[model samples]
Target: MARMISAPVLSQEKRERYDAFRQERTFNAYSVGNDTVMTRIRHKSLDCSPGCAVEATLQLIDGKWKGVILYHLLQGTLRFNAIRKRLPNITQRMLTTQLRELERDGFVLRTVYPEVPPKVEYSLTTRGQTLEPVIMALKAWGDEHTTFGHVPEICADMKGSPTNS
Candidate 1:
């Protein structure tokens, strides 16, 4: 007798509305094996009021590197070292920690393979993919005003390598 809670899947119509009203609330289903136990959608976190959707979001992704990590994963699945290559500035400990947090929060899925080398890959869950528009919006804003250079520059800086002007 064990309980497992997989991510919920929204329908096509609801998916269309996901981006627009995602912040205002949340919903999830609980189950034990194949039997669904319960489901709920509500706004209890913000004193049962609105306007804190953005706050809820920030609580999930508010960190120096989580957003960036999510952005890289958006490209597709990546192995641990590969992710390290992308964000060289992040220490191994920090990267492992963030990845664990993302996995715990249902944003990242980590799969382990039993092999001589023990391969592991990280990808986004359905819930994680829902953040695409938000991540992209942040990228667009940074592109327009940050002048902080793109991924290449960031990677170079992380590696302590010189960049061409």
Candidate 2:
């Protein structure tokens, strides 16, 4: 013997509206009983294409401070204040949000200790360690190309080619 389960049915108009909502690329919503639940659709099913690969990687690290945060974490485990000191420009709220996002994405780990002041430490996970090469390459490129603290000037001895010098 077997038991059959029944699902709640939506009216025709509601079904059409739900279908239209599903057509959007950003998010999808489902109705359960008297409440509606919304879920984000982060990315489409990857088809093993180059564009898909790049998109997936960018989606995982798609924030202004995420890459920099990961770069700092590569050195070693750091407390919240230590990370904040490294990035003095970042606000406490922004750092908290970024850390939460990183933890949610499985790239960073947040561990809390039972103590009088609640010691919390942030460190990179195994998956996050794989980004070392990428982060290092970016750092190298910035060191060579960026003109942050130096005066900008045009080169005169070059003849239209970098190898000419």
Candidate 3:
């Protein structure tokens, strides 16, 4: 929906509504003949914490399997097979892809050992541990509003019983 913006709205002898909107928007300052400043909308600052860091965090751990993988990884080191066992719904290819991405993003530490069957374990990095509180809070909120209408097994550990009980 587009409205015909009045000429007064564009004037520097401004209006409260225009000022409020200008303050909220990000713009590029422009100079006209050495005496005026202009603003334009463009991509937000990459250094913005929530815009960048938060997005990076979500990128590393967002999606159906990523959170589940992080949840399992929080329980100390676990091998690839162990993660697979916990997240049975995820396809093998996707699980591998998510782990690789997390590892690349510094959210996970992957260790491999020389063994006949080839053992590889994944655990959280220091940066990854920063997500514990976030993930736990999400877990807490989810437990409070479970679609299952029952406490999750993870919550069961905290209170020593299911939510209903």
Q: Write the per-residue lDDT of candidate 1 for residues 1-165, one digit (tens) a residue.
A: 899756666567756665444443333553444323222233546655566777678878877889999999999999999999887689999999999999999999999999988999999999999999999999999878886545775656655655653
Give me the displacement of residue 8 in model 3, in angstroms: 40
Q: Best TM-score goes to which candidate? A: 2
Residue-by-residue lDDT tens digits, candidate 3, 1-165: 898643222446444645654543333332443323344332255465556877655655777878878887888998888888776668899999999988998889999899988889899999988889998998999978877644478556544677555
Judged by whole-model lDDT over C-alpha atoms, candidate 3 comes out at 0.73
TM-scores of the candidates are 0.63, 0.64, 0.60
lDDT of 2 at 35: 27
Evaluate all candidate structures by whole-model CA lDDT and list the values in order. 0.80, 0.79, 0.73
Positional deviation of 87 in candidate 2, in angstroms?
0.5
Where in model 1 is the C-alpha error above 4 Å?
1-44, 149-165
Rank ordering of all candidates by TM-score, starting from the highest = 2, 1, 3
In TM-score terms, candidate 3 sits at 0.60
Q: Determine which window of 10 residues in candidate 2 has minimal summed lDDT.
A: 150-159
Give one clash count per candidate, in the order shown: 0, 0, 0
Q: Which ranges of candidate 2 are over 4 A from the true structure? A: 1-43, 150-165
The digit string of per-residue lDDT tens for model 2 on 36-105 reads 6353443457665768877778878877899999999999999999999777679999999999999999
